[model samples]
Target chain A: MVSILGVGLGVAALLVVQTVMNGFGEEHRLRIRESFGDCVVIAKSPIEGPDVLIARLKADPEVISASAYTEGPALARRGAFSGVAFVRGTDPLATDQPVRQYVVAGSFDGLDDGRVILGIGLARTLRVAVGDKIEVWSPVMAEQAEKGKAPLPASLEVCAIVRTGFTEVDDRAAIIPLRRFRELWSLGERAHGVTLRLKDPANAVATAARLNVGKAGLNFIPWQEIKKNFLEAIRFEKTMLFFLMFIITLVASFSIGSTLFSAVIRRTREVGVLVALGAQRWHLVGLFGVQGLLIGALGTALGFLLTWGILYFREGILDLINSLFGNGDMVANVYQFSKVPLHYDAMDFVVAAAFTLIVTTVAGLVPALWAAGRKPSEAMRDA
Target chain B: MPKVVLQATGLKKSFASPNGPLAVLRAVDLVVHAGESISIRGSSGSGKTTLLQLLGGLETPEGGEVFINQVEQGLVTPRKLLGHGVGFVFQNYQLMPELTALENVVLAAKIIGRSQVEGKARELLQLVGLGDRLRHLPSQLSGGECQRVAIARALINEPAVILADEPTGNLDETTGKEVMKLLLEVVAQRQTALVLVTHSREFAEKASRRLVLAGGVLSSA
Candidate 1:
């Protein structure tokens, strides 16, 4: 019975770990899908050309919103404070995606002017915030201006503070306007690229297909495709984890096998009796295997029920913890949500339960065969 | 005169040992008739058990064929023959410890496709005087009581023949006699051939036909 408990625990732990790994990967994918629309159409040509192309896209019914963006690697400096940064220039009115919802201070309307929006981390590194003046310098722009002599100085003021939790984007990037970016880059009639928000993300393939310009000198790649490498890695890891965890249940199966073997050895006389009484070899095998099946079914059912029950009350438990801590917003900062985000998938439960049953049944083999192999007289002789 | 129920001719069996091939049964011939109780007696290691196994079709003979109920034992696999017509009772009271006495009997009845398994299981248990202990597991029963359950299991199928390899070998002398009495009574009631293998002269003498097996063959004495 204790061994059953241990086996159950081993199976449950493997299932839970697999589930969490799946959840983590799914969480990231969903964040990306929700953050960036299914695709971002980037042009290698000048920024203004893409801005003009975006206008045509915005008029299309399938296009939700098409916004031009100017992004480049540069240095953000304020007095002696200098930190390297990547600046993304967007039409604020057109590019107010939910990812930009974390604007902390100042007006998003200031992007039309020379004022820039800075991420909290970038603002902290440069020691500046909304209403603070900062110099934006790009080496490409600096080198181009020097060729013409009398470099263009675009001294900008930070007007909005945005806090996106993603460290990759939030800690290193700032946002400006499309026109100001073209001015900074000394490009004529060209915007860097157009980011399109589609009516339905799943229609990204169709949308990219419709936007295909055979000789247009630009690529419209879906966000999913761009991040396919990351998604594929996660998928591979999940497969590896599944097999690795199955090994735990396999070990538990060895226990079943050993238990059945001992049962067969001790019950040799009883088996002989059954054989004498007209029991077939397969019948004896089935009988012992059925016992194994019962144990596995009972243990798996109990473990899954326990797991589901815990998951069911998990929200209440979190609330209790939050109330005990006397902080209503405690969970928000820790898990980035007010509630524990647990998604229950029926497919996940079925796969896990079925897998456990197979493992347990395989464990019953050795002992069943041992019992069936005994000759009635040979077993009876021992008695 | 009874009709022959089991026949084996020149049956031979051997086992691989460190020394050489140890012949357990060598060129043996046996015949058992329906409604007749035959006792095979032999000293230990004298091939008495081997002869019984060969006659019962429980083990395949190295060189010859065993026939049960006019069906060639080799033609019908051992498992099929055992399930359909052969009823065996081991000396150890080989009752399944996990199953109740009722379940043990019901299992044999179920195996042979008998009708009214519950009624038959109950009737057999009653025949062995274990009707009250129907639900008792083998572990809960005494040595004699377990043997009674084994007897009940054997008769549940109404087999064409019954094979008992020292059915009372583990019981006290009195208990053994009582068990033998119950076994003979049940076999008589079912009209099944009874083959009893034992070293006990008391059991051997009770059989309608007594044979002693030595040097790999049986001869009536």
Candidate 2:
């Protein structure tokens, strides 16, 4: 039972931890896909003649959607409430669709009518609400605004408040119409970059690398490159976790080995009897191998059950842990998300079960070989 | 009138002693025919059990060979020896502790890849008068009862030669006599050869032929 439990614990940890980590990685990737199309074709400076370039990109079958986009540091003010945020500008239909999907308050309907959408965090920081008009100061267009030389839209109405659920992204962005971005920045019918949504997000790397965006003097930046460090860290931790869990499983296998070893010792006379009764060395080996596999199989099955139990009440479990420890935003900060996700992959179960069975079978083989190697006379005499 | 079913010629076995090699069975020979009962009696350490083990293929002799069912061919492996009509009954009643008495017996047929042996196990158990205790593990059975199970196990394959190694050594005199009577009766009914090793002269006297093992040699008694 101890051996079974040891293996069970290791399997449970392996499944639960791997799944949760996979959940975090998948969730992160999804958010990146949603927020930044599949990839972006970045330009060092605004493309002066982007009409032909944008049309050419849209013609590519792999490009699901494309948008002229711009972003820069901006200051927003409503009465005494003032805050700094990244003012992201996109075509009314281009970024408006995503803003509408995530909008928690108001609507994106009036965004092109000299209106802006603020991320929930940015809205809260500026202490503004839907229908409120806020003054804006742009670092890139600051000289033109002070000299009154450029007819910039000095006040933009807050049409909506969106919460993307990613607090890091939510805390910084204020979405504005791309036409206004061009007017404020003194650019006419051009954009700093274009965001291209691909049919498959993973192909963003290859698409961006091979795309002929240089015709417009535009460079390329794939989303994978944009989020490389963060995703790589997740992958690295997952691999490290797998290694650590494997060590734990190996340790459990040792317990199984010792149990079988002791069983062999205790049943020495019985083994002798078996051999005397016509059992061959291979038969004993097979017998012990099956015994170990049975234990491992049972443990893995029970561990799967345990994982189900854990996942079923995952929210409550996380809540309980947080409440007990009284660590504010503990899970949110560590995982970069407030909630824990349970990823159920049959492949993981298969791999874990196979690894466990092989380890335990090898563990049992040691004692079985020891028994088979013994002469029946010696074993019988010992008893 | 029974033809020879088992034979061992020039069987030599020894152990390494501190002073020198301890020659146990220097030169031992035995022959048992079908339906024949042969008893070999010897002092402790006279190699009587060693000779039985050698004949049973549980141990290989340092020199010489053991042959059974001589009508067939090739050297006998311990594994093939069991299904090739050879059986063993140990004094310690070495039935597998993990198995029930019936499973212990059924194992004999299973080794030879025989199916439908549960009924055979049941029959053997009934023959040994443990039909009601078929599901009882070896630990649950008494010493004599365990010995009876062992005897049933030895008979599962209807072996041509049943080697008995001090089969009654662990039993009381009364139980030993009872077991011996049942054993001889069964062997006679099956027409199988019986090679009984024992310390008791009385038990040896019951066999059709009695031999004394001394100084690693066998002599008619």
Best by TM-score: 2
lDDT of each: 0.75, 0.83
Q: For candidate 2 chain B, which ten residues in a row score worst on lDDT?
A: B70-79
Candidate 2 ranges beyond 4 A from true positions = A49-52, A74-85, A92-96, A99-136, A140-172, A206-216, A333-338, B16-21, B74-80, B98-100, B118-142
**Per-residue error at A70 for model 1, in Å?**
2.1
Quality class of the docking in candidate 2, CAPRI style: medium
Among these predictions, the greatest lDDT belongs to 2
Compose the digit string of candidate 1's lDDT tens values, residues A1-383.
74466467656766665666666676657656655556777756554456567778888788888876667888889999988788876666664466556677887776765788888789999999789988888776679767996665568899888765556666887888766776777656566677777787777877787876562777888767867887899789978887887787778778877887787788777677667656777888898888777768876877676666656776776688778987775545643443445555667678777877776766676688778888876776565
Clashes of each: 10, 0
The DockQ figures for the candidates are: 0.48, 0.51
In candidate 2, what are the lDDT values of residues A168-272, reduced to their tens digit? 678888888888877666667877777888887788877887785455466777778877888899899989998999899899999999999998998899888
- The true-versus-predicted C-alpha distance at residue B195 of model 2, in Å, is 2.0
Compose the digit string of candidate 2's lDDT tens values, residues B1-221: 66778878999999999988999998888877888999999999999888988888778889987778745663344435755568898898888788899998898789667789999889988998999999999889988899999889889988888989999999999999989998998888888889999999999999989999999999999
Error of 2 at A335 (Å): 4.8
